[model samples]
Target: MTVLTGEMLIGFSAVRGQAGEQRAFDPATNAEIPAPVFGLGDEAEVERAATLATKAFDAYRTLPLARRAAFLEAIASKLLEIGDALIARAHEETGLPRARLQGELGRTVGQLRLFANEVREGHFLRATIDSALPERTPLPRADLRLMKLPLGPVAVFGASNFPLAFSVAGGDTASALAAGAPVIVKAHGAHLGTSELAGRAIQLAAQETGMPDGTFSLLFGAGRKIGEALVAHPAIKAVGFTGSRQGGLALVRVANARPEPIPVYAEMSSINPVFMLPDALRNRAEAIGRDFADSLTLGAGQFCTNPGLVLAIDGPELQRFLIAASLALVAKQPQTMLTQGIHAAWQDGTRALDALEGVQKIAQGEPVKAQCNAAQAALYVTDAKRFLADGALQDEVFGPASVLVRAKDFSELLEIAERFEGQLTATLQLDSADHDDARALLTVLERKAGRILVNGFPTGVEVSHAMVHGGPFPSTSNAMYTSVGSTAIDRFLRPVCYQDLPDALQHDALKRGNPLALWRRVDGVPLQA
Candidate 1:
């Protein structure tokens, strides 16, 4: 057993909570780092942390937004300063490249900064005051103010693949902290070491910025008990999770079944299917094939946004494109997946695809040893009618695998796209010059996905203001909020409506006089004056 010493165990309060624990390994070397086991947290501890966070929220929420911004800035700086080491450890644990790790680190820091800027501007709080109409024709209207407030403490379940950007100091933690809610991060088992490192960076930032100590807590344990304890805990007002549909749904059911059910923003897995139209397939089948091959194989296809499914109308052009794509994928050696469980899941998925009726394996990947037990990218194809009949075909396989759906005609292709459930992204490969049916397809697809792409793959998720990284149902737990973007802060907050109140009784942002100088539009006119 490789012992974890140094900063790894520091600040982490070890409790007797191991139920079904396993050793996390360095994927590159397949060496055990430490036996990470965590079970249910003590009920008393859960309540205590909740109480502390609630008590802290009253004052913390009232703190100057500038001070809050400073805290976020401090976290961003700490992450950047230790970014190289963090990325190295991440690559060691995840088997991702330095370039990929570097990019994820940038995303993490960029997310922090985005939220910081959002809070600093104070527009996200959405302060609105409908002034009193003391006298009217029938009845008098009273002064009413509405603003968004933090929903007490939040429980964040870190994801396995993105150990940095989606774990510990990931978007959920950063957004929750910025929303004035204390956070308790449930670390991902596969990346516990990385989670701990990021946790310390967060703690250091908190202390340096003088944020409340109980405002953040990092707990580690194994099994479903810890997760059940966290979600079922009454103190946890909302949940943020990024994982499989099974795991995410469990949390949602727990929260929903609670006495006072809370929101669970679970961005469960998706196929992120890409559709190739006849015109585009005929014109640039080879180029699109290369692009899809790269996106599907990138990160060993660990990304939730991985284009696991590709749909196209059946023709010589479609056959040529798919053959070329599968060849490109087969030429690439198998890369390490995020974890053993993920590798197993991917293999199982491959087996299932192989077993499907009318499904034929067009390509299979050969093994290579850069990291842990690896699997190569595989491509499978089936007719659209069969695919539409089998709902299981829509599920995410979670590795370097892509399934091609061959449609008999353009109408069949549209029907397939319409039947797709909620997705993180949906792509349409059409010539820029082709607009009639493609435009109509875009309208239907818009209802099914958060992001729409044209002539591109869906694997690369850009962290930006314009990005909307969530969709309906299984694509995400909530469609109203985004997991990435300036808007992620919305998940951590709830609206508070105030009726005719005295000056002191009103919130500072909604006082008798507008004092925060917050961005406001009054009666369809800018308040710039």
Candidate 2:
């Protein structure tokens, strides 16, 4: 990967706005990577982008769905074409393996294709037209049509853990572009180089497809001030974010505190718990323990859906299996986390876990050093009764840490599942012989998470059309929308109701010509009315 020079980083105005200057640094070597950082947008630039988006939305929103879909497909092709180089830069910066970067690149392209397909189909418009009744005994029904319209400008905050899939060219930006909403992305400082590379690719695609020049913007910086200024700016109509609960909540407060609070879809982290039944514990106790340890430490436990908590029915069999499984996790070489802030946060999480009363440490990891990487590992076991009584125990630790809860009986196991906050996914370890009891527990977990698995881990999120990513609050601010599948575009749109208007005045979507031919419900029949 070529190192970006200070001169190359000089500010350039792509949209009508003026982006501010911010310095760039290399996270891997902790040295200055470039000078005169030109991409980082300030409050003034944000205002200018919003103005241009509002001006452009008048024409962009009326474009046929097929045309919009074609633009998205072009972006997808560009992403696939440059997949290898992007993955290499990602590995150089984050210290991740080639396979992981390749997988994430696939997911990013898959999301773009999924959104394009969704736009082409046009069901997301959710058009509903109520036929008019000119004459009735007492009342007359008026024609009313409803279809989703793009919010003017959206502010997207990138995540550190997923630089490619959640950064400049990630799901949020792709979905918003497909929805006809112009986007301004706040890039994470941890992966600025990766963001710049992908950002250039997107610009090339936009130019090739004849998209509006100011439609997409990428900004990078180290402090919270830039983000706060962007969110609080009046031009920003909506916000999309993925990070810690505290960071998400702070953005939420900013949006809500505004004159006109916009919707903030913040996917905060969670302790996606896996419940292991006693019967399964008796049968594959050793196997389950090993799998749990592997899943807990996968990617150094940087995933938001990492299984940080484990709930199992208490018994001698369960205890014996967990002890053997945890001890088997030999102290491996420490790996670099996403950023220094993440590393510090991991230590804070470990401190919180250690401070919990009655928590027994089954294992401990070596401390990370100044120059070399370090892996701090530990296993804390506690009683289910204590877990339920202390609400503080449910907080996510954000690393390769696991808390095993020993429930006294089957009833206590069910109670623990019910008490869990919203999560991305929940896993169940069950024995085939105990199908009846497992079903009971599975049913309880279904309501608590977006995806429920049987005898599997929740760490690997498949980027498929059938995937439902967002869950209840704390997991995500919106449960009805997902951030990983074709459905993610819905978050960038808002429903617009149309009343009495001639064909000339009506939007193309509602015009008699039915130019887009999108599916619509007219007089209780599914048709393009």
Candidate 3:
């Protein structure tokens, strides 16, 4: 087992950063871990990592596909080998329950193996060949072959809410590596120790698998300084980030200002909305209300897809829902949040909402005298007139706080849905008879959200091939890409065309007789050898 140290992993070497330092905190205990004071990085360290990655880009990207797949598998094995130590550090640093961290660890490893399979599958390369047309009617066409190639070094910003699955060896790292790009991660401040543990696992995996020395690196620092510097580094071709909308937009601005601008795939804010159609609310207001409370409180509502807004008709059913939700919410105890800053932000947002003219405070959980940096679950109500009139109503509270909006009728409900900013998810609690209402909402939701649900909440996001964990503008900087699943590899790749290139000069995938036996399009027709 590796000892906890405050050093950053800069390729094969572990160098202690010379910049200012900080320690991890146990939010649950309201105290610091008192060990392994983490050293923050600055432009100097970013220069070293980015330079090494530039030196290693070709060597890492041109490795045989099978060897690349094996490298990913090795990373998964190394994470598993770390075992309970990783989960324990994550729990202490983030104040997350051990069981939840255990599951997250599994997800972290699972995504690495998933990207491994993706590398072997080879569809992401998008190999295509248009054979030479020597006997065309008027003009002959030259042979053209195209395939996707990895961009250079990528910068990844670790997410605070998901220390394991979206941090050190998380989706961004796994997907970029699968696309054959070198990675540089900026560790989240809240989980420095946990990030170091996972970073060590990746560092060891790279060495053990004969990967290039600078194929991966992890650094720690303030986002404004080290993070923006990393993005502005000429060697970095793209970036992956998950955090506040302000932070994401800041990185985007830096990336665009560079001499050679780069893409930033950032998953930011979202206030996932839930619509209870007339029939569904009438049939099961109590059930929907209880489930809504549970989803709002899950993981302290730290999830990006947390249900922040609820919409329904203002009627007896809506009244029934308020009563049932109030009963469930008020009985729940306050839960420890991730950090002091986040807890304070949630407090500010809730207070501001309560101060709004027409927003009614329906329910609030038990007082938070027992836990440090804890948040009480809360539910509020307002009419569509007030909700649509105030843009502040759309602001994300970032905790277990939600507001319900009562519309006059279905038209007003649709109007409320259309008024939403970009969101990660929009959910519908509908039964068979409510399909027509759901149908009308689906068309608008398709344009408004990345994912839609039927009769379910958005708290649980499945990590699968079909999942789209991204959205437009406020939800993510780039709506075309997903930060999760197999397709995420596309974010770090670009296509290149070879004009009448001889087989001897081509890679195996583009060689004659399909040397690698991968599926390729020849003469515009897909074929497998």
Top lDDT hit = 3
- lDDT score for residue 339 of model 3: 88
Give me the runs in candidate 1 sitting further than 4 Å from their true place. Answer: 1-23, 34-48, 368-371, 523-529
- Give TM-scores for every candidate, taking all chains together and pairing residue i with residue i: 0.93, 0.91, 0.99
Ranking by TM-score: 3, 1, 2
Distance from true position, residue 168, model 3, in Å? Answer: 0.6
How does model 1 fare in lDDT? 0.81
Q: Pairs clashing in candidate 2?
A: 6-35, 11-38, 365-377
Error of 2 at 401 (Å): 0.7
Could you give the C-alpha RMSD of every candidate to the true structure, in order shown? 2.9, 3.0, 1.0
- Alpha-carbon deviation at 306 in model 3, angstroms: 0.2
User: How does each model score on lDDT?
Assistant: 0.81, 0.77, 0.92
Model 1, position 22: C-alpha lDDT score: 51
Show the colliding residue pairs in model 1: 38-221, 38-222
Candidate 1 lands at a TM-score of: 0.93
User: After superposing candidate 3, which stretches have Cα over 4 Å from the reference?
Assistant: none
lDDT of each residue in 93-203, candidate 1, tens digit only: 788888988988888998899889888888877877777788765998887778899998899988988888888888998899889888888777777667766877777
lDDT of 2 by residue, 181-203 (tens): 87778878777667777776676
